[model samples]
Target chain A: MGTRAAGQVGRSGPVAWMALPALVFFLVFGVVPLFGVLVLSFTQWDGIGAINPAGLSNWRSVLSDPGLPHALWVTFEIMILSWLVQTPLSLLLGVFLAGRQRYRAFLAVLYFVPLLLSSAAIAITYKALLDPNFGLGAGLNIGFLTQDWLGKDNLALGVVIFVVSWQFIPFHSLIYQGGVRQIPTTMYEAASIDGAGRLRQFFSITVPQLKYTIITSSTLMVVGSLTFFDLIFVLTAGGPGDATRVLALDMYKRGFQANLMGPASVIAVLLVLIGLALALILRRLGGSTTASQQEGA
Target chain B: MAVATSAQATSRREAPGTSYGRKLLRLNWLGGTAGWLWLVIVIVPIYWIVITSFKDQSAFFAQNPFALPAEPTLANYQLVIESDFPRYFLNSVIITAGTIIPAVAIAFMAAYAIIRGAGSKFLAGVNGLFLMGLAIPLQATIIPVYLLIIKMHLYDSLLAIILPSIAFSIPLSVLVLTNFIRDVPKELFESMRVDGATEWGMLRSLALPLTRPALVTVSIYNGLGVWNGFLLPLILTQSPDKRPLPLALWTFQGQYSVNVPAVLASVVLTTLPIVVLYAIGRRQLLSGLTAGFSR
Candidate 1:
C-alpha cells in the first residue's frame, strides 16, 4: 500500500510542474502588481523619479477631493445608464438573431463589425462623423443630425453612452443568442399548448431560462464600463470640461498625465475594490457565474 | 415586421426540428424592427468610413459624406502607407504573436494539469487563484506594471507590452481552456493510461488534438483582444516606431487631424487585416465564441 501510494505521488508530481510556467508568469505580473498598486499608493513617486514614502497623505487627499466623488458618480452613471440601454436591446437582438434564417445570419455578420474595430478606431470615426460643421449632418443637410456632440456636458455624456452601446450591443447580443438557443424547445412547445402568446412565452420561458446569461452579460457590461479609458480618452479626453471623466480615466490622468503617481495609485486601489465588490455581489445574485454557465452549456 | 420567407414557411410546416417550431412562434415583430433598425445603425458608419476612405481630401469636403466617391483616389492610402504605417503594423503583429503563442501554450498546459490532477490540493488551489484573478481589473494595475517595467529596464520595449499582456490573458484563457479540457471523456484518458502513455505523451497526442477546435477558439479570442489592445501599447511603449497599430492610428490622427480622408484611410488600413482574418475564420470564430462564452 505504501509503495503504491508513493508511486501515485511520483506520477502526479510531473503533472503539477506543468502548471508552473503560467502560475509564475501570473504571480510576477498579475498578483505581484496587485499588491504593488496598494504599496505604491502609500508612497510618493513622480512617475520618473525616486519613490518617497508619504504615509497616508496620498489617501487623505484623494479621499477628501471633490473630483473623486464626481469621477465615481460619472463612472456609476455610465455603468447604470449603459446597462439600461444595452440589456434589453441585446436581449431582443440576441433572440432575433437566434433564428437560423439566412437573412438573420447575414444580419449577425454585419452586426458584429463594430466589435472587430479597435476602440480607438471607433472613437476616431465617431469624432469625425460628429463634427458639427463638416460632419454627417452638414453633409446630409439634416437638422438635429449634427450637434457639438462632444462639446457640452450633458451631450458629451450622452454621446459616450451612445458610442459605448454602438460598440458593445452586438457582442452582448451574441451572448444572449447563445443563451437563447440553449433553452429546450420543449418548454416553448409546452407553453404553446397552454396558449401562451409570444410575449407571454418570452417573459415566462425565455427570460427565466436565460437568468444565468443575463447575469453573465450584465457582469461583463458593468465591470467593462468601469474600464472605458481608451475610448473616452480618444473621443473626448474626458472633456469638454471633465464631463465624461471616468474612474479609469481619472487614474490615468492623475498618474501619467499629471505626474501624480501616488494619488493615481490610490484611485487604482479604489477601482480594484469596487470591481471586486461588484463581481462578488453579482456572483452572489446568481450562484457561481462560471459554474452556472458551464452547467447551462 | 416579420419578413417571412419561403424557407421559414417551409420550415414551419416540416416536422419541428430542434429549433424550427420555436422559430415559428418566436416571430417577433418588435424584435425584427429593432434588429433591422440596429442593422442600419451599425452599417451606416461602416459604409461612410469605407466610401470616405476612397475620396480625395477636397472631394471629401465637397461631396456628400454618404456618397460613393465619384472620382475615387488612392492618395489617402498612399499617404498613410508613407507615414511609417507598415512599421507600426509589423510592431502590432510581433506583439500579438509574441503574446498569444506563449500565453496560449502555457495556459493550455496549466489547464491540462488542473483537469487531469483535479484531486490534487495544490492544483485545485492554483485553479482557484486564477478564478479570483479573473475579478481583478487589469487596468488598475497599470501604474505598478509601469514601475515594474521601468525597474526591469524593459520600458519602451515591445517585450514590456507583451509580458503584461500574457499575464492578463492567463486567467481567462485558463478558465476557458480548462472547461474545454474537462469535456474530454475520462475513459479516453484511462485508455491512454492503460496503454502506458505518459501524461506528457497523452497531453501531446490526446488532449491536444481533441481540444484543437477549442485551441483555435481561445487563440482567436485572445488574438483579437491583444491585436486591438490599446492600453498596454499606449502605456508601455514610448517611441513612435515602437507603437502598435492602435497607438499608431492615434498619433496618425493627431498629426493629420485636418486630413480627414487620410485619418479614415489609416483606420481602414489598421482594421483590414482583422477583417481578412475574420472572413477566413468566420464560422469557427463565431461558433467558437458562442460556445466559449455560453459554455
Candidate 2:
C-alpha cells in the first residue's frame, strides 16, 4: 500500500506539469492582466505615460459622470428589448421546427445563416441597403423610404436592436429546440389521451419543460448585451451624437481613443462585475428551475 | 396563414377526429408558413447583396435594389482582387489558424489536466479562474492589452491579435472541453493505469481519440469566431496591408463609395470562406454552441 501510494504521488507530479504551460499562459494573459488593469484603475496613465497616483479620482469621476449612467441605461435597454423579442419568437420557432413537418431541417439551416456570417458582413450589407444616396431608396424610387437609418439618433438604437435580434434569435431558438426535443413522447401521448388540444398541450407542456432553457438563454442574452461592441461599432460607431454608445464602447473610447487608462479600467471592472453578477444570478435561477422542469412533464 | 393541403385534410378525415383536430392541423400549417415567411425575410438581404455584387455601377443605380442584375459583370470581382483583398485574406487566414491551433491545443491539454486532477483543490480553483474569464469582456482588457503589446513590441503585428485571441479563447475552450472530459469514463483511466501508461500517454491515446468529436466541434466554432473577429484586429493592427477582411471591408466602403458593386463584391468574397465552412460543418458548429449549456 505504501509503495502504491508513493507511485500515485510520483504520477501526480507529471499530471501537474501538463497544466504548467497553460497555467503560465493564463497567468501572463488572463489572471495577471486582470489584476494589472484593476491596479491601473487607481492610477493615472495614458498608454506610455509615467504612472501617477490617483486616490479614487477615476472611480469618483466615472461614478458621477452622466455618460456612465446613460451608457448603462442604453445597454440595459438593448438587453430588455432583445429578451422581449428573442425569447418568445425563438420559442415559437423552436416548437414549429420540432413539429412533424417536412421542411423542418431546411428551415433550421436557413434560420442559422445570419449567425454563420460575420457581424461586419451583416452590418455593411445593411448600411448599403439603408444608404440614402444609392441604397434601397434610390433603387425603389420612394422618397419617403430614404431616411438615414443609422444617422438618426432616435432610430439608430432601434435599428441596431433589430439587426442584433435577427442574428441571435436562431441561437436562442436552438436552445429552446434542444429543450423541446428532450420532452418525452410518452408525456405527449398521455396528454393526447386526456384530450389536450395543441395550444393547451403547448402551454401546459412545452413552456414549462423549457424553464431552464429560457433561464439559460436569458442569462446569455443579458450578459451578451452588456458587451455589445461588434455589431453596434460596425453599424453606427456609437454614432450620430453617441446614440448607440454602449458601456463597452465607452470603455474603448476612454481607453484607446482618449488615452485615459485609469477611468477606462474602472469601466472594465464594472463590465466584469456586472456580467459575472448577472450570469451567476441567472445560473442559480436556471439551476433551481431544473428540478421543477424535471418534475413538470 | 396557409390553407391546409389535401394531404392534411385527408389525414384529418382518415383519423376521424373532432373539430379540434382540424384546428390543430390548421395551426401547424399556419405556424409552418409563418416560419417560412420569416426565413424569406431573412434571406432577402443576402439575395440583394449577391445580386448587387454582380451589377455594374450605372446598372446598379438604374435597377431596382431587390431586382436581378440587368447585365452581370465580373469587373467588380476583378477590381476587388486588384485592390489587395488577397493580402488581407492571407492575414486573416494566418491569424485564425495561428490563434485556433495554439488555443485549442493548450486548452485541450489543460482540460485534460483539470479533469484528471479533479480531486485537487488547486485544479478546481484554476477552473474557477477560467470561468471568471468569460466575464472579463474584451473591451475591458483591450486597454491594458494594448499597453502590454506595445511594451513587448508586438503592437501593429498579427501576433498582437493572435496572443490575446488565444488567451480569451482558452477559457471557453477549457470550460467546454472540461465538461466533455469529465463525462469520459474513469474506468478507462484505471485500465490504462493498470497497463502503466503515463498520464500524457493516456491523454494522447485515450483523451484525444475519445474527444475527437468535441475537438472538431471546438475547432470549427473557434475558427468561425476568430475569422469573423473585428475588434482585436481593428484596435491592435495599423497598416492597411496588415488589416484583416473586416477592416478591409471598412476601408473598402470608403474607397469604393461610388463603385458600390466592388464593395459588395468584396463583401461576398470575404464571406465566401465562412459560407463554405458553414456548409461543411453546420451541424458541428451548431451542436457545439449548445454543447456548453446541454452539458
Candidate 3:
C-alpha cells in the first residue's frame, strides 16, 4: 500500500518515503498482533505447547462457565459503585476549585497526590490503614469500620471499590476542572444579576453546561472500573473465596495462572466488546448535546 | 408625648447589621470551612504512609498507629537499601527511560508527518491506527504478547517489558503530540522547506525544538505509566533479579506478611520517586491534562 500510494502521488518525493517507518510500525505491532490475538482465541494452546485448533470450543466453554457470569456481575457492580461515588464528588470539587480563590491551587495539589502514587502503593497503604488491628482504624476507635476488609466475603468487594474510587477521584476532578474552565464567566455574572442563588445557578448553568465532559469522564470511569486488575491483584489476589474476583482478574487467572489461554481469550474479547459498546453509547449521547452546547455558547 | 414615642419606635426598628452583609459573611465562612476540611481528608493517607516509613517495627506495632514516631528511626530505610531494592529501582529506571525516549521520538516524527503531509485520507488512516491501539485493552493482548515474548527468546529480560511499554504508550504519545504539532504555526515548516531543508532536517531543526514542552509532558505521562505498571512486568519477568519496583514490592509483601512496618516501608520507598516528580510537576501535569482534553 505504501509503494502504491507513493506511486500514485506521481512525484519523485522523499517526503512521502519518510512515512514508511510509521507504516511498518503500525503493521507489525498494531495490526498483526491484533489479528494474532483474534485467531489464537479459537485454538487451544498452552504458553509452550503447539497450537491445536479447537474450532470455537473455548468460546463455548467460556459461555457455559458459571464463573464468568459471576465475574461479570462483580465487574459491573464495582463499575457502577465507583461511578456513582466519584462523579458527583469530583464535579463539586472541580466547581469549587475552579473559582478564583487563594486555596484553589493548594486544593488541586492535595487531591492530585493520590493519582501519582502507584496502584500497588495505594493498595498496600489502604490495606494497612484498614487493618483490623494495629492500624489507624484500630487506634482511632473505629475498629468496627475496618472489619477484616480483605478477608471478609461481604465487605471485600466494597473495600476494593472504595480504594479504586479514592485513587480515581483526583483524575476525574482534573477532567471536570478542564470542562468548567471552558465555561464563560459572563454566564455566571448574568445569572447573578437575575437574582438567582448559588444552587440555582449551579444546576441551571454548570450541570447543563458540562454535559460533554461529564459523559467523557463517566465513560472513562466505567471502562477503567470494569477492566481494572492491578490493584485488586496486588491487594487481595481475588482471595477470601473469590469475593472480589472481577472479570479482568478471572481472565488473568484462567489465562496465566491456570494456563487456560483459550478461554481467557474469550473473556478478553467480551471485555473489549463491552467497553466499545459503552464508548459508542456515550459518544452518541454526547454528540447531540455537544452540538447544542456549542451553538448555545 | 406622641412625638417622643414615634422617634423611639423608629430608632428601635433598625437592627445592628444589614441582611445582605450577614448572608455574605455566612457564605464565606461555609466555603472556607469546607475547603479546609477537604484538604485534611486528602492529605491524611499520604502523611500516614510517610510517617509509617520512618518508624521502627515496635513503634509501628505499638498502640498508637497515627502518632508520630517517638524516636523516628531510619531502620526501615536501611532495610530497604540493604535489600534488593537498589537493583529493582535500577531496572525500573532503565525500562522507563528506554520506553519514553524512543516512544516520544517516534511519536513526534509521526505526528509531524500527519500534520504536515498533504493527503487527508492518509493522515486520517494513520490517526485511526493509533486510536485502535488505545481502545484495545491490555488484557486482550496479554496472551499474544506473552507468546511473542517467548518466541523471540526475550522472556525474563528487561527488553520484554520495555518493548511492550513503548508499544502501548505510542498511541497516547501520538495523540498528544499530534495535537501540539497541529498548534505549531504552518509558516515555520514552510519557511524551513523553502530554505531547502530535508524532512529530517526540518524535524530536527524546527518541529522538535518547538514541541519540547509537549515532549516533556508526554514523557512524564509515559514514565509514570511504565514505572508503575504491574501486569506486563509480572508476566514477563520470573527472576527476582529482573523484577521492577512494583513486582519487587509485591514480593516483599508476600515474604513479610508478619512485618507490617517493613512492607509499608517498602511501599513508601517504591512510591517516593513518583511522589517527588508529581510535587515538582504538579502545575505542568494539570496543564497537560487540560491540553489533552482540549485536543
Q: Which candidate number would show the highest TM-score if scored against the true structure?
A: 1
Q: Who wins the lDDT comparison?
A: 1
Model 3 TM-score?
0.90
Q: Score the docking of each candidate (DockQ).
A: 0.42, 0.36, 0.27
lDDT of 2 at A83: 86
Q: Tell me the whole-model lDDT of each prediction, alpha carbons only.
A: 0.89, 0.80, 0.77
lDDT tens string, model 3, B1-295? 6456445544543542354345445655654565566677678888887888888877777747678889998887888778889999999999999988888887787787776664656766876678656655655577778888898899999999988777788877887887877777877766776677877898788888888878888888889889999888988889988989988888887787567778888988888888898878767878887667532
Once fitted onto the true fold, the runs of candidate 2 whose alpha carbons sit more than 4 angstroms away are A1-7, A100-102, A142-145, A287-297, B1-23
* Native contacts kept, each candidate: 0.66, 0.45, 0.32
Off by over 4 Å in 1: A1-7, A288-297, B1-27
Interface RMSD of structure candidate 2 (Å):
5.9
Model 3, range A237-266, lDDT digits (tens) per residue? 887788789888987899888988888888
Pairs of residues clashing in candidate 1: none
Q: On a 0 to 1 DockQ scale, where is model 1?
A: 0.42
| TM-score, per-candidate, Cα-based | 0.94, 0.91, 0.90
DockQ winner between candidates 1 and 3 = 1
**Whose DockQ is higher: candidate 2's or candidate 3's?**
2
Q: State residue B12's C-alpha deviation in candidate 3, in Å.
A: 32
